[model samples]
Target: MCEHMRPASAFWSFRENISPSALSVTTDGKHTVVGTQNGLIFLNSRGRPLWFNKKIRKVADVSVSTKSGKIAVGSSQKVLYLVNLKGEPIWHRELDSSVIAVSISSRGNLIVVGTDLGKLILFDGKGKKKWEVHLSNSDFPVNSVDITSDGEFILAGTDYSHLYLYDSNGSVLWSKETGSAVLKTCISSNGDYLGYLTSDCKFSFCVKNSRMLWENTFDSQPLWIDMAQTADFVSIGESSNKVNLYNKSGRKVWGFANESSRMGVMASGGGNVILGNKGGIFNYSLEPYLKRLLTGCKRSIIKATEENLDVTESRKIYDVASKNFSNANFSQFLINIHKARNLAREARVIESDSVPSERRLERNEVEEDPIVPQENTEDEMMAKLVQLAEMREKGILSEEEFIMAKSKLLRI
Candidate 1:
């Protein structure tokens, strides 16, 4: 299934090391290379560790070439190590400054590193120097670097707000002033698009030729951004709330909200995206885009049942969706929920005029059982409000969830 249409499933999650900060993940086909403050850990598709290298302390960055399955690790100790799937070192390069960023090409023929001294170095697969570039404006340090899958384009971002694009022979293609500081940057697998997030909280995208395709500014101050292999979409992870999804055209497609700020984001060949944080990593859907659609379906189903429009079918579908909402098999649940949504939409069409109010239903307006009497008096509503407030205060629900539930109670 194409990832943009495939339903998402939450898969195995692994906790970050005790340090939590300075975390990243690299995907090399079937292997996942995780870089933490302490060391490098390799995991398989099932999130099982295949091998680990604790010898490199304070691993600052990691890159994995999917075509060649070569793993690159950069450390604060000013060293870069290239290893294979079995965790065997192929070569090591000691640099002049602490390594801050690293990237590997798809076939593993190209390697690039960014350092605290504002130097960008490129190396061949055999550890031979290909080219190097030094930036005088990288005073804030070289924080992020990336190379195209075919190893044709190179990108480096610094805290001084300068972004440099390089060609295969180490010549500067172009440079731009993005923002006060460049937080992160990524390149599409085919080398057609480049995306970046800035310290001032702006996420922007550009074509390979440096023409601005689209740009978006955010208040969440996203921590990381990555381009999908197809360059059709980008994912930005915010420090406080949602991990947002945007298309190359700058359309906001989806947002996955969590309590914590995930550290890094990675895209898969199938368009699936993974997020890593202290609580572990989570897999979220990129294709089917059902989260919003499902919510609308639930609202429509309730309205249809209350208006007596194909009541039997609407209620049946509603019941199934309610059960599916609690189901552990999320991928299957999404598929089934979508079917239920179709039923709800059909039911609404059968009796469109029955609901004269026509106001879009709020989250609080939908009754789990539309047949149940919800006409509570104001005093009764206050009592329920108190009840919900107590539940929220008791830590029985997340603050956001509590607020939503309370809003629903007030609607009653």
Candidate 2:
């Protein structure tokens, strides 16, 4: 992928490392809310700090209700806060254990909270408890939870590497095992796609009705995370400070790496992308043309090595010849080089063999013809042409033979 835009000069500087937690954006995209390890809530805009929570004990997760103007924050202190847009607490509730995850329905009428002990609490718009489900056995904790955009299902990730899907009526729909603990998950606006980041640093997105749509495994664990989706693409982030962009077809589009270890924020509006890290917030104009060029280059390298070229000289010839061609023509070049190289290798083997001639061919005749009979003019010329062309293409033929064969072929 091509990075056409440079990092913007705008940036937010934090006094300390951003604690491992979830980050969220308001529905209007005007403000961002993040939870800190020390139970603080921070609201930021354009690399500028807007508000900070002073009294909230270390918040573990936070989510914004797009329709109701409510912000739900969960803490390890076994408390959940329902705050308004101005960051004022509207209500507070205690869970049986430390709250690990929280998500608000799009209409803001419902709030779902997951506890470290694997219990789920559902509250109505007014903070009244509607239902609660305990998933804790002897072995797992509720790692994360997300409600579908249409309020049809509640998706939860567990510490034991499994995902449980529950209908709005609190019925289990389906469950699937992941490679590792699922760290985070996000569903698309239309409710047809779901994306998740795993503890193993692998990101996977799939259609809600089927198996995996696409997955990417990384070398480092992801920290703060968010995803942007379009009809054709999805972009994900890592706490190690990188943004991995992917196509809807499950291909990697490109990636942005941050040199600074600061937490990075990502959001998309209209067609523009906003990236925030320690350096600042930058608005990047998407460049599809340049991205195509880079993606083409990457595909060429992958296709070049897919076939076995060692069995034939043609394969070797095409492999070497294609390097000089334009990136788009590399596949054809590879084929040509392989054919030429194979032929040359066969010719060498034929010439190296020492064999006695048939009794029909006298010693004198064998000496006169060498490899081919001198009297057979057409056959001799064709043999010479093939040899000369092969050698010249391989950079082994003399200038004289190369020119002679060229003249002969042109005359014919």
Best by TM-score: 1
Per-residue lDDT for 1-412 in model 2, tens only?
2342234322333344455354666543456676776554445555356666767778877888756788888889999888887778899887779998888887777788888887877887688888887763533778788876456778788887877777677777777888698777666555556777788888876666535655667667765444443223455655444555554444444555543444433432212234444323433333432234233333332322342212344344544554523342322332343344334334332333322121111222222212222444553344444434444555554566467545745465
Off by over 4 Å in 2: 1-21, 37-39, 42-44, 136-139, 229-232, 259-412
lDDT of 1 by residue, 276-374 (tens): 667575555444443344565666666667767675665566566556545433333444554675566555644566321222122123322222234
Count clashing residue pairs per candidate: 3, 23
Reference-based lDDT, each prediction: 0.66, 0.57
Give the poorly placed runs of model 1, Cα more than 4 Å off.
Answer: 1-9, 20-30, 137-139, 290-412
Model 2 lDDT at residue 15: 41
**Residue 271 displacement in candidate 2 (angstroms):** 7.2
